[model samples]
Target chain A: MQIRDLVRRRTPLGWKQLVHSKGRMAIATAGVAFAVLLIFMQLGFMNMLFESAVMIHRQLNADIVLVSSTSRDFASPGTFPRSRLLQAVGVPGVADAEALYVTPRDWIKQSETNRGERAQMLMIGVRPDFAAFRDPEIAAQLPLLVETGTALFDRKTRGNFIPFRQAIERGERPQTELGGRTVTLVGTMQIGSSFGSEGVLIVSDQTFFEFALNRVPSAPSVGLVNVAPDHDAAGVAAAIRARFGTYDDTMVMTMEDFIEHSKGRMRRDSAISFVFTFGTIIGMIVGVVIVLEILSADVHDHLAEYATFKAMGFSNRALLGVVFEQSLILSVAGFVPGLLVSLGLYAVVRSALTMPIAMTVERLVLVFGLAVTMCALSGALAMRRVRKADPADVF
Target chain B: MELSRLSHWYGAGETRRQVLFELDLVIPRGEVVFLMGPSGCGKTTILTLVGGLRSVQQGSVRVAGRELAGANEARLIANRRQCGFIFQAHNLHRSLTARENVRMGLEAQGRGLPPDADERSERMLAVVGLADHANKFQHQLSGGQRQRVAIARALVAEPPLILADEPTAALDRQTGHDVVALLRRVARERGMTVLMVTHDNRVLDFADRLLEMEDGRIVAARPGAAAAAPVNP
Candidate 1:
């Protein structure tokens, strides 16, 4: 009679409905959970793909990149006279600058070692002291490269290409051959930290020119700049690019833009986002349908009882509230498992690969919010029977 | 209270089939009335109308001072708390225990009575010989016992008007007689306005008044030979 008492009494009925018909409810919960897992996996893969693709840009310590107009974006090579590096340094409010070149190509004899894997490896050519803006570990490992005839390899490049089979098969050391040069393995870096050849080779400019005997005029055309710690790099980048022109293609990138550029194709092709977006849509649709049908069937199964309640003088609004609560309870029970299963599956995929598959609290919140809305809408739609069933219709 | 020109039909449009015809009838409040008729003679329809479960289409029905014809939905709902109903199926919510079902009726009126609700429910159950079965589920109890719980649920709300559609139709003759005797005693003791639709002549002795309905019309009304004067108590 009292709304509170009806609710207290009615809650057990929903629980009983869920338990009595475990077969259907279990299947329904599974359907929703499976959908959630699928979406989580898609999102994780997206993160990993972008992280690996943009490793060089992300690790580059450049605040303001000064490049020719023809270059693709920051961390990309720009062929202007070496004077541009000086021009960048002399500009008002300028502090410090470093020059390097980035290029992508198959190993000179990568096929001979059969490590010509599918990955875009970045090539950075700069001075040993210029290592400040190149590979971060370069500054730490300068002593090795200082010994002459030595080089530093980018960890990001190696992680992107080499697998456990080759790394462990060669035991305690993993080395790769590129550009007719046997670049000895110096050290390893963090995951997705490579910029070139699955192994970053750091050599002096004098040594770089010997390897590039047939290449274009290379005066370290790509400059990595360090701003006065207090100045905004993005604002400086915008100002310099507006004033600069590339005899070769050039562009400037803020650290954030560089990272977004790393996720470039994934974000742009829309197909990748489409797959994730598609998973979300399918998840919600399936959740809605399963919830609707199950609750609808529940209403039907309890028709006589509903009529009895009506006969006892319960209002239509009262019955509506019960059904609404019932649907929410079902969704909450189902969603918790759905989210857990999804996170567990994501961990498995991340452990099984060298990709950057990731999960965030925001993603869980999103899925939960969607599930609640879908369940509530489904419940409202399913209450037609409870509202319209006439006690007179029953014997 | 009275039903004038009462008749009911099934379905709509071309498929409609009339089940009851108009017949004038009267029964006073706070009295126990037994509505008897052969199976499918629309005995339940009259009870439904009086209980505020169905709208009266072709007749004027005055129940507890409200017209059954075109009654507002809100008023009709408010009418529910003033009445109690039991069905042939003993329609207690199977998911609830005996006491919870009784509490549900009282709760419907938003008056928990908490500590007292349990005690009152226990007493009502004992009155119907189900005090010990209060914790039992409807499915766990025998059919007759289930009916007793349903009766307790109906009375727990303390409604002045109580209607039953063959409350004991599922019980054996002895159990049926006991159930009716309990209904009679409860009605008289509580001063409840009670009417029950039943084909079970075996329990007719419990009725203070008998109204025989046929073809949806009340053809005769006979008061008990020793109908007691209305007791204020």
Candidate 2:
């Protein structure tokens, strides 16, 4: 027989077995879908955690950045000399250098809105023309923050203490208190809240200096360094690093390197990653257990039939092929409903949590592959019953 | 099909118990031979050994020109393909239709089936008086119809040897007679050898030869029989 005909003839046995009991098949498919949903949710949270951890780092406009050697992350940068940024100006591949003042500032929401909530927000101060934020919406709003004592509120920030996004949507400029000083929310940007900060605000450097109590104008937390087009950013970062290697006070790195640095820190230090990792493993285990139970029952139910096949000259390999095929069917059948449900769940999560949860091609392929592996493993483990199907016993 | 000094036992050490003792049987090509015995007489054991369903433990078992003693799994499978099987339980896969069950027999040959494999299944089902029930599952068929499906599945591949363990035991007397007649007719027409183990006296007339077994021994042989004294193991 041709290969196609051989394949075609042998392929329907598994499907026929699965569909023999419609209720059982439905239950089995539902069980598999539950497994897939669990895997998707856990992995989705992991993806969100990783993506959200690097949100600020990904949005930096500069190709290279200069920070204190003691700096940890965006919200934890130590102070560096402003002259270090100036020293970087003449380096090869350096396009421009601008200071970024980052500090946590306490904000008090007005009681007129029914709650006098106080929160510490990460305040980023930069010049209007050389804004450090990379998003076009924020860049477009930078010119509006040039006015003294005015700032662009992160529209994606959660919490209703000030209605930041709502006010902007209503075409109203709401004034808010930062560090016990009044500041106007003149425009809005789209950097959402992170694990380290409850909210984020951007302001002009002049207003930052005025509102920052006892802070010197000569020192800044970080220096944003843009690389010239046609010049390598890493080379410029290397040049800056070499120039500052002797200073013992500052570190220079490309934006990509800094983002990795932040992500590495989050992965090693945060419980968010740990929880998601554990959840994903648990999901896989649950999936394996459910499939094992279903496949085991299936094998048990069909023991006599398998024995008859053996007596009729069917190879053990061919019989096991039927089980494996059933597993693949269950995996794929359950995965479709699970994926559809997960997509809907993702939308709900994105809307409710205002986090960076999303479905990616890599993640879809990964979970699907894991699901198949999970079911295949269960099928293999369940083949013990198939092996025990003795034709002598059947007779 | 042949069996020589086929002494068989179960378990090991102190739990060991013998089943078949010094069993010697032979059936020539195209002959319908029936081995009639009471319960616990090792009739099924001998059938399984000859069908390559069980390993030969203490004797020689040759069927379709291949010796089964110490045969590897591949060799055993190859030998089994040359024989067809029907059982008292009507061991048809409940999930498959009668037609599909019959096709499974041809598929078991592992050789390329003819393009008219479906037609062959249909024709075989018709021969078994199950043509109208071809698309029915085992659960949907009556006991007799299920047995008929088993018959079709066994004979569909046109195997040289057919091993049946009480093929008509589950059917009514008339149905049993019809099934046995059908089996005899098909075997004679196809020049197929048959070895059936049965305790049912009602179907004895269908066999071309009969051997009566008692306590794992062939105690009586008559009507074209080669008589031999019962040998102890």
Candidate 3:
């Protein structure tokens, strides 16, 4: 018979064997299920963490983020004169220039009125049509923010997730005056993402500076740059470098570089990658043990059958193929259900907890491939006893 | 087949006790011989040596003119395929039906049984008087039936030689003699050279020639043996 047919015919015998001994198959499947589940959990945690990190930077489309070289990252400060904004707009390939502001703030707890927690907020001064604090797609009319006393809030800031039921129930969500007029809470939505789940507020440059006390007067503005169409971001950065000539150790990070910088910052303390690694490591260890145990039991229970096969002149290679096929079948069987469970959990948590759980085809395929490979490898190692078995030995 | 000065010992190096002494003998094709001995007289050792199941140390054994003493692994395996072995205990894959067990032997000959493997297995089972029990597992069969299945397994490969080690040791006297008679009849009908190890002298009536074994050596043959002394084909 062709080897493939033998494997095909023989492994279903493995399934029959499993069915006849339901308890044994269940034990075997449990091992595989847990291993698959582990990999899924890892992917879930990683997606949530990585997507959240990149989302923060992906939503901001600045050409360059000029920060003080002495500043560690967005968490710290580098300030320059507001005149630098005019100089940035005058560059040859420049489209528009705007001053961006960022700093930490206190977000009053939604559940409790008396206590509030520290939350980092990105305070952008809306310049006629800039929806820097909210995704452009979500905002209906960006030009409306140019009014004298108005502000928009990014709902998905640090502990300040927007569906704050408690605050809505209390009938008070911090109404205050700004720029000599009542700044109304027209509407609210997410600005894609942030380093934390805290909230952010946007207003006109006049209203924001007048209302929020954190705006630095030590130096007028943070930094400025233009968004260009045809020119490479690096080229624009270079021109900005020539214009400023590294005065006060200024660091001109291109849009890509800024995104890369934010990613690095998030990665340094990435809780999601940690959770993912934790899951994968646990999965591998658990998978090895389960596969080893299940394989050992099947071989032991069928010692005489394997001995008969050997005595009947089937080579060790043939025996190994049969056993390896059995392992793969068990791995695949358990993985199907395990993956379904993981996907269900991800969907539930994504909608219910307001946290992201990314399910990419590439990652799903990778984890599936890994699950199969892990089973085959560990199963083969466990079945080494069969290959070493002597007909005379087993008999 | 020939054996020359072969011996085996059991236990560890220093504590070892010899089982088979240095012995010399020859078995020929188309010959049905029976060896009778008491327990622990090393009848098993001699059979194991001839079967290529033991490591040949002191001397040589040759089956179908292939040297067994210094034979490499490949040659020994090939020799084993040409011989069919029936032991006292039935060694069958319990998960497989009686037919699959028999077909497994046929499979070992590098032949996939035809689509009619089941029909062919039924024929072999009928030859051993087990056609009615052909679909049952070994555990479902009586001791006599299981032994019949094992005999069917031995013959299914169409081996040139057949060896039975106490083939009926677990059965009643009548069943034991019946199996012995069946073995003799198959040997004569199919031209199989058979060597059976038995402690039961009652089964000796079916042997064409009886060789008495004592102290790991075949001490005597039938009274008219010298004239049959060519020893090889």
True contacts kept of each: 0.50, 0.62, 0.24
- Give the lowest summed-lDDT range of ten residues in model 1 chain B: B224-233
State how far residue B21 of model 1 sits from its true place (Å): 2.8
Q: What's the chain B TM-score of candidate 1?
A: 0.90
Stretches of candidate 3 off by over 4 Å are A1-16, A61-94, A112-128, A133-137, A141-185, A191-195, A199-261, A268-275, A393-395, B109-123, B129-135, B173-181, B223-233
Interface RMSD of each: 3.2, 1.8, 3.5
Q: Encode model 1's per-residue lDDT on A249-331: one tens digit a residue.
A: 45566667656754674468546667767766776787788788888988888888788777777777776776787777877
> Can you rank all candidates by lDDT, best first?
2, 1, 3
- Summarize candidate 2's per-residue lDDT along A220-266 as a digit string, tens digits: 98888998998998888888888876797988888888888877777
Chain A TM-scores for all candidates read: 0.75, 0.91, 0.77
Residue A98, candidate 1: how far off, in angstroms? 2.1
Lowest summed lDDT across 10 adjacent residues in model 2 chain A is found at A108-117
Error of 2 at B93 (Å): 1.0
lDDT of each: 0.68, 0.84, 0.68
Largest DockQ belongs to which candidate? 2
TM-scores, each model vs. reference = 0.84, 0.93, 0.82
In candidate 2, stretches whose alpha carbon ends up further than 4 angstroms from where it belongs are A1-3, A110-114, A135-137, A140-148, A161-176, B111-115, B224-233
Model 1 DockQ reads 0.47
True lDDT of residue A322, candidate 1? 68
